[model samples]
Target: MAKRKGTVFGVPVVVALFFLGMMMPTSVGISLGGLRLSVYRVVLLVMFLPMLITLFSGRCGKPHLFDALALGHAALALVSLIHWGGLQQGLESGGIYIVEFAGAYLLGRLYIRSSEDFRALARAYVVTVVGMLAFTIPEALTSVHILHDGIAAVTGGAPAPYIDQRMGLERTFGPFDHPILYGVFSASAFSLAYFVLAEKRLTNGRGMALVLGVALATFLSASGGPYVVLMMQAFVAGWERVMGRLPTRWKLLWALFAVIYACIDLFSNRTPFHVFVTYFTFSTVSAYNRILLFEFGTAEVARHPWLGVGLGDWVRPVWMSDSMDNFWLLIAMRYGLPAWALLVGLMLGLVWAVGRRKGLPEPWKRARHAWAFTLFGITVAAATVHLWNALFVLFLFLIGSGAWLYDARLPKRIGQPPRLGPPAPRLRPPPERLF
Candidate 1:
């Protein structure tokens, strides 16, 4: 066999494979004994095999801090096990969380190299989401008919599961387990597509068309989190644009003032604000459960403020409730303050990186802005739902990758040109002078 030369495009290809794998149906295969393996899982395993082989063969770069994030998550799980009581429960809950995040970290590190790689990955994600939405919209509309037929065929009866009051409007789950997951996925996809369209280098009529289609899908999903994210993204992008026209000092001051106001507002209106969110934003079940879970989680934090109830032990008495809806509360209940601090630190670091490099090349800037919007959206969504799943993990990876890229391309000084030297000589030197 000949030695293969590694190509630059391999990164994006790997990323695309991972995203496609994730988006595949979970029930696309059969169960072998107790382990239920799906086509999607099998494909991801196969795709990962090559990357593993390449890594062992010294063809890939060493893992960076992004990979460390996965390890940190694992460490938090370990800590939870020690604090809670047993490893079994931790393995069941926190273990799954760790695996999801590890997978996301590995995927992000696998394909991200240059700004072009980022764009390609983002494009692939957008295409997959839009394509899924296009295929599923009609299916969702006709789900009642399809469900009726399916039920009749199985039971040979007139009454069907579709007509049963248990199931609401047949929501198109696509490859995911629920319509809410689809909604979150669409929201992130919509944001990324918008960013792609906004980028000067990548924007076109095609991109705009895709963005509009994805936005419609997001609206249809009726997932309030994504909508909130969209609004926040718009505000941030607009703010950035306005900041660009102002002096650097004024920009800094404006940012500081905004932060101060946000802090004040957040503290002053926590109860009524949360009430408004519950009333207006979430599904009835989600809103009710989230409130209960948040209360339980907060109490758990108060009791075990130091080590937490133990990582993955949030389901225990103090922290245990029927509803484990909020991601932040989940973190607080499972990992305690230290783990929560680490997660918050990571998020803040990403935000700082994005804010610092507000002015960059087109795709790079868009990537950062999109990431900021996604994170903010995820945070809001987390209040109503757990973000330990594939969608949230992917969103985190995107934000991290964007921050990494932005920092990689940051200008050397606050407002100075990247290079301090005089412009390159326009005329070429004579061959003799080249010596």
Candidate 2:
């Protein structure tokens, strides 16, 4: 609440630090007892107790379905890991994963208490993305990652090397571990900035500029996953603006999508998903790899449906790489179906609950719109690419941040507005006398 240098634009100091820590290179960390302590992890550790206190104190309102699902997903992940690896290794890996997932979610749930708080978060996200442009622009031009190099040099860890080139330019990963991750992080801010920080209109120059800044950062990643997220959010936002007056626009859009999907399935040899992958990627090889990932990954899930293979290597062709690009498939293959179900349920349920709420203030409505748009984009993008580490945690955090809206109170009407002309005569003022 204090106006201090550490807390900028009403964002709490802890949240500000968390944003900073997230942008730190992955190599900037220390190892303890075989567990890594990265900067953001340390911040989470510092805030974990406070998050627990606030969560249990009833200040954040009753725990929602998504909250329980988040915890259950993490717990199941831990149990699944322990089932595969021995308890010792499992505890190490799974404990860290739990801390990353639930910790981030609870922190968001605790700190963001109102629509104004969410606007502060939007400001933080926009500022973070715009500031990173200083480094991203250089990285995009020179094909060098100064943050990775500088952090690695200080920490004596190996710097992340340049990944494959696209469009004759090196992918600009910025401070994230991968180009896709960086893109996702940057792309996540588009709707938040446009809808929360600026007026939602083409004429709102500042809002348009903020969203454009986020898009630029997303584009620098040069990865299909980020492109999908940015473009999806843009499409949804545009639809909301253009078709806003049509009450059943969303239903109409879904109907159209279903028709197209049915036609694709009926007429084409390839499934709709396969067609999507083949056409929506930066390269055919990438699309082909994702197709194989989907096929083999789902097979593995079917083979071990209850508790999945955990950390063990999944069975795939010798030529096929071990890495999976599909987030949903990877979850089912790694943890199990239940874990995937809980997570998916949480996401969709949150979206449904928030969208169903009535009488929220106009600002709260916009906040809900922004949050939903961002989540929908990320959710769709995850099918084409996997999320891990910071991006994964950030997704859960954003979800938690929006959960406040479900319980948000409608704005109280103080009184009717004053009449501009002379007050209405006898009818209003002489009721008792007339009676």
- Best-matching candidate per lDDT: 2
What's the TM-score of each model vs. the native? 0.72, 0.92
> What is each predicted model's overall lDDT from 0 to 1?
0.59, 0.86
Query: For residues 177-234, could you state the per-residue lDDT of candidate 2 as single tens digits?
Result: 7888899999999999888877697788888888899999999899999999998999
What does the lDDT come to for candidate 1?
Answer: 0.59
Q: Candidate 1 at 127: error in angstroms?
A: 1.3
Least well predicted 10-residue stretch by lDDT in candidate 1 = 159-168
Candidate with best TM-score: 2
Tens-digit lDDT string for candidate 1 (1-435): 232244223345445555655564453445654444444345444555564454346434554453455467657756676557676655555544554454455455454655666666667667777776655676566663342243344644343222221134345555554456666777776556767654522347787788777776666555566566556555555566667666574368558867766775777655643564576464676565566666667887888766676633443455345556677877777677777777776676657745775557665667766666667766766676666345655665665455455335443455665767889879976677554
